[model samples]
Target: MSGARQFTDRADAGDRLGETLRDRGVDADIVLAIPRGGLPLGRAVADALEAPLDVVVAKKIGAPGNPEYAVGAVASDGSVWRNERAIGGTRTDEGYFEERRKIEAENARRKAERYRGGRPAPDLAGKTVVVVDDGVATGSTLRACLSKLERSDADRIVLAVPVGPPGTIADLEAQVDEVVCLETPAGFRGVGQFYANFTQVSDEEAMAYLER
Candidate 1:
């Protein structure tokens, strides 16, 4: 077979992703990594591409009764991507939706500010933007992030990740110019399955990645 074909960790996954992007002649003006888990991979990708590293934050709007189950997501600038299927199926009430939207939007804004650390947000206009995330599961948050980038007028948006299911990747392809994913295997589990050292990244640890 062709080796293990799985990542040792987020950093290893990012190294492979960076190599893939480079081999494909992908060029980017900036690399925007989704905060928390994506920061490590984002740092590696930015270093590989010789581009500035930045963050794009989005908060999941969880179902009222099920806080972990996302009904939608809102980006830092209040741009939103609703999981209409889930919302209709769950029949989420207007009061819950509005309340969660406001709260999550504010949370996203604060996270964006923290990641930027006084640096003026980069202008995405007329620029090829590379968006990095460790891996996607439900894809709600990533969709919201892409929607925010869409509103910001990024010239071209490329979504890069180490592993995601084929169907998820296909759906994302409609939202971005290119989707660079390393493995799309069958019998998909959580993203953590593809990594060996899938440690929980602390807030301080994540912020440190942005600094470097």
Candidate 2:
């Protein structure tokens, strides 16, 4: 990436991203943010688009012996996005992947239920949905969420983020109707590198953003 930081914080990044979406005349019926970090940005983006905000939950299926390395991801609705390259490189077996997928899918479903707090899931049929995230690296979780949306009756699906690597961005473009990424830095390391204050977001704080 550039030597200078791209954003002071997530809120700042969200403001810029929201502005960019507005300038592009992107219409959204609802904004679904990946919980925790994405909630803050989703708030700003929802406000900008004049739409309701909600969370689209997914959990990363980490590699064996290297839990931080994601081999795939599973969405709340059992939608999955597997990284064939990562699976092959990590030598993740079919049984292992299937077990993890079931576990993670249940985890994601529980999270979505908790985040929704008993409210019915959004009616996405024929509606334009925008999926927001703080940023992405491998984008496993995002791909899973997008997969869920793709299987839904949504009229259109848009993926929006603050920054990501070029290769990941290009791959994501094929999965959605449109992508609204503010920055795609060449020398990317991780999403936090582009922000000056990349603090962890709590579930409590994340849920608050959905309160309107």
Candidate 3:
């Protein structure tokens, strides 16, 4: 994906993603964005599709020594995705994984509540769901989110992201019903590098998207 237009920010990425989805006639009954960054994009997608926007929460389970490195992730309902390679490579103990999973799951649940604000969760049963994100890297969090959705009654699960690495996009294709990624460049490093104004989106700023 050469000469791709750099995203001005998360909102710009979301706008582009919305246009792509609309062009494909992607009809989503609901749009769920992973919080803190995905919200901006989710808002655009929901508006474009004329669907309701909501939050889907997940937290990374970092490795033992490298707290920044995600070994896996867990969703609000305790649905988990574990990176066996990361665990084995780092010799991450079972006790450590267990502890983090529990903690992260709880954290995810809390975040979801905060964003939704006592609103009952939208019924995914027999509904078309589009999970929007700014981008993807290792895809640990996304895998966990998909796993959680699989356990639900969602009729279809489509993942729509603005950009992602080719390898990660390939792997995720097997997990979801469909993938709509605008850019799948092999030269991907981090998600931030593709954006001209890739700023850190605070929880306060992220939550505002949900309110609107």
Candidate 4:
């Protein structure tokens, strides 16, 4: 299928992906979404599988002088996943990373509190966690999320997305137990390019999805 026709939005994509997993008898342990965009998609998957949905807040740490270029990402649990390759080579300074970490950590905390509403995170012990996102570009955020989840007591980690660059999907395959990506295009531009109605997901909307 063409990338243009793959998903109406993150929610629609999640529905189709959930159906596919059901067909394969993959009830993927627990649903974890990267808010705030991933929450709506997570809700659809949770409803489809009759599973619980929770948020995994991770902030991308962008390189100095280039906010769009991610050097790493940090999870809410204080887990930091760094791309050593991106460092030093891209003129990324030492003190800059430390500063970014502090700022991103605070941002992640606010997002967690806003969406979770003081709700305790689910115990991942002995459970298979399915991590969902609206889409992926460089996979930096997901890399950190999966790294954090791996340190947890979860049995397995499955990364799911509606669409992503082919290279990003390949890079994640080794890190995740399973990857359920609907579209991996070589000519990928951005996540929004693939969706017809890719509006920004508000924190309020994300909270409502979690409450459901």
Candidate 5:
């Protein structure tokens, strides 16, 4: 994929991604998207693959004083993925990290519960689980979601996305059984850069995708 190329929206990207997966003969028992941006794409992928859609939630652990910058991320199940370089660069101590981790983990748990609404988590045992996302920049939260999946009984784990930076996508590839990224663009600044309509997805809209 060209670094200069852009997607029309999440739906267009999802359609293309689903076609790519089919072309590669990839099969999925379930599609787990990282919400809330991921849900839109996951819906298309789920329809294309004729699989069920669900969410995997995670919360970013921001750097000290810079809440927008992620030092790490924690999944709903307490699985964590830390950016050691970010932590060291920010001079964040263990105490701060632990405190933030606990807080953010609980946040993630609540969000997941809210999204699922009273439904139980899907069983992944002996199943092919394809994890979807809109796009990845630093991939802190996505990594945390992958960490949680790694601890599951899934027979296979695949990461799918519309776009990502080369380095970040490459790093994520090592963590999954297979990766189906449509674009690994050069000079990547952020995930929204590759999309024409990158509006923020509300919790209500995100949850509706699962209901479909």
Candidate 6:
């Protein structure tokens, strides 16, 4: 039998993650979630921890012919994380990266506006900040988000994801103060494969969760 269990959805995963964090003494001043996908999970965590929920957006820069192949990713504030191995071997051009960055930058801006509604980003000055995501596959996007958080005045930066591949988790541990992942499989294929009901999360649904 496979070791993997089930999560009804991202929210359920987040709820369990919150409890695990609490047990592990994950005390954060605020929870910033990567938007669209992570917002719902963030909501559950924020509610559990009684912390404010904020939004952070990351857009993946996929290689040509393989949209799922994230060679790199960019955060809302223009921080970029590239997989060196992917970049060195792939046929991706500088022009492709530039073009993708332009499109992703605009997409990030639009998401920020829609999600935050002109509200200023949370003041992380000297406060512990936990960045939550549903799961991570390539680790490019999570690295981008963590890189941007490092620039902030946060006292601590914790990356909380429900599931990830074992190798990805090890790499992430070298970057963040703490990495909270529920499952790390050696034969991990993708994040959705671990979930029972892994469905696309619409921006409207994300906003609705934030509104409440």
All candidates' lDDT scores? Answer: 0.90, 0.94, 0.91, 0.84, 0.92, 0.84
lDDT at 199, model 2: 96
How far residue 70's Cα lies from its native spot in candidate 6, in Å, is 1.8
Instruction: Judging by lDDT against the true structure, name the best candidate.
Output: 2
* 1-212 per-residue lDDT for model 1 (tens digits): 12333889889988999999999999989999998999999999999998989999999999878889899999989888888888988999878888898999999998888777788888999999999999988899999999999988889999999988889999999999999998887667778888888998888888898887
Writing each residue's lDDT as its tens digit, candidate 5 over 1-212 gives 55543898998999998999888888999999999999999999999999999889899999999998999999999999999999999999999999999999999999988999999989898999999999998899999999999999899999999889899889998999999998887888888878888999998999999999
Candidates' TM-scores? 0.96, 0.98, 0.97, 0.94, 0.97, 0.92
Backbone clash pairs for candidate 2 read 1-187
Clashing pairs in 1: none
Q: How does residue 110 of candidate 3 score in lDDT?
A: 91
Model 3 residue 147 lDDT score: 91
Between 1 and 4, whose lDDT is larger?
Answer: 1
Off by over 4 Å in 3: 3-5
Model 2 lDDT per residue over 1-212, tens place: 46547899989988898999999998999999999899999999999999999989999999999988999999999999999999999999999999999999999999999999999999899999999999999899999999999988999999999999999999999999999998888888899988899999998999999997
- Decoy 4 TM-score against native: 0.94
Task: Please say which candidate is ahead in lDDT: 2 or 3.
Answer: 2
Give the per-residue lDDT digits (tens) of candidate 6, residues 1-212: 16655678898999998998888888889999887789888998888888889887778888888877888988878888887678767878888887887787677767777798778878788998888989988778778888888888789998999999888899999988999998888878888887888889997888777776
Ten-residue stretch with the least lDDT total in model 6: 1-10
Stretches of model 2 off by over 4 angstroms after superposition: none
Clashing pairs in 3: none
**Per-candidate clashes, comma-separated:** 0, 1, 0, 0, 0, 0
Predicted model with the maximum TM-score: 2
